[model samples]
Target: MSKRSESFLRSRELAVAFKASIPVMMGYSVLGFSFGLLAVSQGLTWQWPVLMSLLIYAGALQFLAVGMLRAKAGLFDLFVAAIFVNIRQAFYGLSLLRPFRKTGSLKPYLIFALTDETYALMTTRKIDPRLKRRWVLFYLAALNQSYWVGGTVAGVLFGSTVHFDTRGIDFALTALFVVLAMEQYKAKRKLLPFLLGAGASLIAMVSVPADRMLITAIVLALLGMFALRKRIEDV
Candidate 1:
């Protein structure tokens, strides 16, 4: 193709990817801003929130890390917590193996950037046939992260200057998850997964301390899904 045609195709791919990522941008901007504001409020330097958002990019874990940082947690403790908090990403990666196989040099960055919102957008949104899939994926991941990082920076700047009550701000993350879950249910119309997850969460909440509840629920849900794999497949 001519240079003009190639440029046009690239722009089209980026436009489509940006449009698809708009929802995540809305969600991440608010959550990431909350994280940054919370991190700074907890006595962390402005650099910590910006660095974590740029490098770690794990929303929930970054929230958890604020306390860990305040407590001066050991590296090993952070490592373990990170693993427990992000174990779900392993499952997300499994589902994307085929689509990512041909991503070439971009594979590593794509894998690193596969946040929950990114995964949802990638799996649920259909790609434009005229645009290259790999480029679209790359643009989506990049754009989402940019929104997060931008929000983090904005929060850090604002928090450093203005003091206000941040109570209940963390609910933004939970609200984002609920929205994503609803979107997934709408797309798949799969009640079994939701039922199993709710059952696991209820059991874990009753049996474990709040600190341990999330991991317990995740483990139980994984086991429940595995046990019911055949049934799930049929459904």
Candidate 2:
């Protein structure tokens, strides 16, 4: 690449970051808004969503945690459930370790903020330099977090009057997983995880209770991960 082109890319990384962040910003806001509405409806205080957004920051996981808490689950139960539900994120981060090595001071934030959407965007995006990559990563995190915080604030303010259908809100998590799975398939052309998840779900649906479902899925997912590690590395 030419020196001028490289310089321009570095300078314009913010624009790339913003453009890449738009889709995630939209999805997270709506989903986060829905969670906020549900939280308030379940008698949670306004700060609940804020704390969730700040502390957990995993969009789908936080929403699931809220649901479990609303159901009167204990802290230990919630923690264990979260371990199973979010173990996928550990794989997501592992997949990005090489791509994220050059993020410098922003590496921690990039790792922490790597939701499925952000991971998809980062993996697909083509940038020239390490600086540009970090810029993109930082912007994705900032924008997504903004959406979550903003949506939660809006929900807290207007949840009482916004009598909309929430039946479809749960699909946000499902949709994200589908998108991530598709991304993985696109990258590796693998069907193992998809089949594994389906098989596990079928077994869990028949044999596992509601609370145990995630646990079973986690075990199955880990086994699948180890089984496919060689395929993944080869790919």
Best by lDDT: 1
Model 1 lDDT-worst window of ten: 209-218
Q: List where candidate 1 sits over 4 angstroms from the true fold.
A: 167-235
Candidate 2, residues 96-198, lDDT tens digits: the string is 8887888798888877777877788878887755556677678777777888888887777777677666566656677767897898789878676677778
Clash counts for the predictions, in order: 0, 0
Q: How accurate is candidate 1 locally (lDDT)?
A: 0.87
CA RMSD, predictions in order: 4.1, 5.5
lDDT of 1 by residue, 111-220 (tens): 99999889998999999778889999999999999999999999999989999987777666677679989999999888999999999999999998666666678779
Estimate TM-scores for all models. Answer: 0.76, 0.71
- Model 2 clashing residue pairs (backbone): none
Off by over 4 Å in 2: 1-11, 128-131, 160-213, 216-235
The lDDT per prediction is 0.87, 0.76
